[model samples]
Target: MRCQPPLKSMVYNWLNNNHACLLCDEPAEQPYPLCVACEAELPWLDDGCQTCALPLPMQGLTCAECRRRPPAFYRVEAPWHYGFPLDALISRFKYNSQWPLGNLLAQLLGRWLNHRYNEDLPRPTLLLPVPLSRRRLRQRGYNQAAMLARWLSGHTGIACNEQVLTRLLDTAAQQGLSARERQRNLHQAFSVTTSAPIEGRHVALIDDVLTTGATAQALASLLLKAGARRVDIYCLARTAKPGSA
Candidate 1:
């Protein structure tokens, strides 16, 4: 026989069944917090580079950067272009500890990923979050990437292991850094745990956003060196090239 949810959980769901939209004050649509109108207005990513998911002028074309120096990861998948209210929402969730917003975004991303999986995107065997250093984790009280991985795991039924990757050095922040600078900042910063057997296993790295692909490249290189079969990045948004509208 199937088991029922706890009374507290049921009651909580009941109370939140008709909550207001997070983007606007209108009644939220069922299964997501945003109303239909607001959802339609989001900064959806239409076409991007074949490898890094950077916004591109045409579909099925690789961005110059990728062609010049391909990223370490196989491919990147993101639903939105980092812009406007989406940026604000991600910032609040990541820096301010607003978990509900993060949960809503993760649910939507999971739905998008499911559709992609049906369309022939290879499903990964494990979901791994980019690890945070101990100091940063303590200051933030949580690792947003880890939270995203866990939520994606719950939504997609994929196993998530937060301990597989770790941050060995508390490097300088990557924000505002050029791609080269960002790559340098991440050097020798991450490692895969020895106990986690990633050999021949396809894995997806979860994060809130993908910018410059520097962090993803570093992590993917580490995973590849550690014997992972393949590495793909899954993030909520991907930033376009600087100075592009």
Candidate 2:
């Protein structure tokens, strides 16, 4: 396919996802959309715990939470933290009704996944996003995590299990919950809706962010119960602070 003209980038973006932010309705840009400043100020989640991907200190190795109880999703890969540009960007994408950003973020995540997992990382037979409750889906009009999984499937050769896992619980938001609290809040929140036999197969759980890994951990348990041999999380952003998780 030929490249689109620079002037039509915004228009193309709009056409791709109703021409709005994935989380918000603010005007977006071409391809990735969102304003330039928002792109620049994106809270890139750098230097986090390799396993949990929670922002870590330069000296100490692991956070108290990870040390006490490690996350269940094997390892995490996030491009940004859940703050600043990413927070605002995700705000527009999630709350503001900007849906295209979901695809954009997915592409970013796919790029990273390809680089990290293609060579040595265990490849997943399927990509399943942590599902959003119907209420949240109705309120938000879309599931951002699902969109990320779709994008990953499109780019990588991994199969997309759109309905493999379902969010059975409509628990409270995890914004301020402690790691333990978050785990408790999400405990038994998810169940497998479609039991695709994954006996000895690897699976990747896609999500927009990995706050405390509780959600991912909970989902992993369910997927494992369903015979998924391994579970890895593919998240767009991770918190850049230990306490944040």
Q: Quantify all predictions' global Cα lDDT against the true fold.
A: 0.89, 0.72
The residue pairs in collision within model 1 are none
Q: TM-score, each model? A: 0.93, 0.78
Instruction: Give stretches of model 1 more than 4 Å off.
Output: 1-15
- For candidate 2, write residues 59-163 as lDDT tens digits: 235666667877666777687778765676667777875655555676667766788766787788888878888899989767877766776898787888776
Give the per-residue Cα lDDT of candidate 1 at 147. Answer: 85
Cα lDDT tens digits for candidate 1, 139-198 = 997899998898899889999999899999999998989989998999999988863568
User: Which predicted model would earn the best TM-score?
Assistant: 1
Off by over 4 Å in 2: 1-41, 58-61, 242-245
TM-score of 1: 0.93
